[model samples]
Target: MKPGLELGNTAAITAKVTPDMYAQFEGQIVHRAYSTVSMVYHMEWAARQIILPYLEADEEGIGGGVTAKHVSPTAGGDTITATATVTGLKGRAVITAVEVHNGKQLVGTGEVTQYVLPRSEIEKKLASEQAK
Candidate 1:
């Protein structure tokens, strides 16, 4: 990690809802609206943007956890935005509060937790998992 990451830092991502983002299970579409899974991915991406500028060449940020609640449905072609704000930082952990919206309506909210680790450490962990 490099310098300059702080609390209250923010980032956002805007996307238009599409059929691919619809609720589905095992390749079967369950609903033709935006899915919780897609919302969570956007939330994580927004959080990742906050750390990108601060990471060193040898450091990588990994998803630690995510908690989300889908409050409303958004149909295909509706534009949605996900924003993340840094809420806490402890040691190598970065915690962010995230919100998803379709225009003025709140669609979902969540928390994203990320851990900064050495790139070598991450690669070693991946290798260990593969060997298992």
Candidate 2:
């Protein structure tokens, strides 16, 4: 965690729906609409923006968890916007509230949690797994 990180800090990102973002089953349309999973990616991107400017060279934020609800369907070519607001911080944990919209209509909402840690610590953790 770094200074200037506070509750109410927010970031927003926009993405347009594409054919690849739609749901498919057996190469056919499952619903012919943007997939809920794709919205999750946008939500995470917005969450990442909230902390990127505050991170040190040796520090990084690792995603911990996300929970989202899709309330509406979006067709391909529709522009979607996702926003994240910092809601809380507990030690190394940073929590954010996320929302998605198509224009002004609310399409999704979520909570995203990320753990702030040292890059060296993560590298060491990966190395430990290789050592085993």
Candidate 3:
């Protein structure tokens, strides 16, 4: 793994918010704008694409944690773009900084940590657990 990767070195990813992605809340006149939870989902997906190429096919990569602040609101009919970059690698974990922009506005920012391991080993471990 490479070191010294900085924040804001980004990979661009975009998605259109559709009805299927909205959240419904009781007593709310309309379904809330795509929730921050949903936005974060896209953010992580973008981050994965950015780092997946760096991982070997038989390697295991796990998204361990995320910290995000939802700064702006986006409703349906909007297109959101997420950018993620490798910021640091500590031991087996890779840290990423991510930002999401809706059209011309910055909507959210966050950091995510992922763990890398050999995929074959991870699968073997899972199978062992299942067998027990």
Candidate 4:
């Protein structure tokens, strides 16, 4: 990490719902509404934006955990926004609180945690897991 990452920092991404984002399982569409998977993906992207400018050349942010809930349905073509706010930072972990909204309606909410580690350390961990 570089410097100046602090709580209350926020980032957001807006996207229009599409067929591909619909709830599905094993290639079968389960619902015509936006999926929890897509919501979480957008949430992570929004959170990642907060750390992008602060990461050192040798540091990378990896997903540590995610907690999400799908509270409302958004149909295709409805624009949605996922926003992330930095809520905590401890050691190498950055925690964010996230929300997904369609206009004034809250579609979902979640928390994301990311771990900043040296790229070499991450690669070594991957290699060891693969070797196992």
Q: List the candidates' TM-scores in order.
A: 0.97, 0.92, 0.81, 0.97
Segments of candidate 4 deviating more than 4 angstroms: none
Question: On residues 12-101, what C-alpha lDDT tens digit does candidate 3 reach at each position?
Answer: 689988776676555343564767877889888888876666676667687789999989888888999988888887788778889999
**Candidates in descending lDDT order:** 4, 1, 2, 3
Candidate 1 wrong stretches, greater than 4 Å: none
Task: Residues 8-99, candidate 1: write the lDDT tens digits.
Answer: 99999999998999999999999999999999999999999999999999999999999999999999999999999999999999999999
Q: What's the alpha carbon RMSD for model 1?
A: 0.8
Q: Across residues 1-132, which tens digit of lDDT does each residue of candidate 2 receive?
A: 568999999999999899888987667878768898899999999999999998998999898999999999988899999999999999888899999999958999999999899999988988999999
Better of 1 and 3 by TM-score: 1
Cα lDDT for residue 43, candidate 2: 94
Worst 10 residues of 1 by lDDT: 1-10
Compute the lDDT for candidate 3.
0.79
RMSD list, candidates in order:
0.8, 1.6, 3.3, 0.7
Which residue pairs of candidate 1 clash? none
Of candidate 2, the 10-residue stretch with the lowest lDDT total is: 23-32
Q: Tens digits of per-residue lDDT for model 4 on 57-114? A: 9999999999999899999899999999999999999999999999969999999999
Model 3 lowest lDDT segment of ten: 1-10
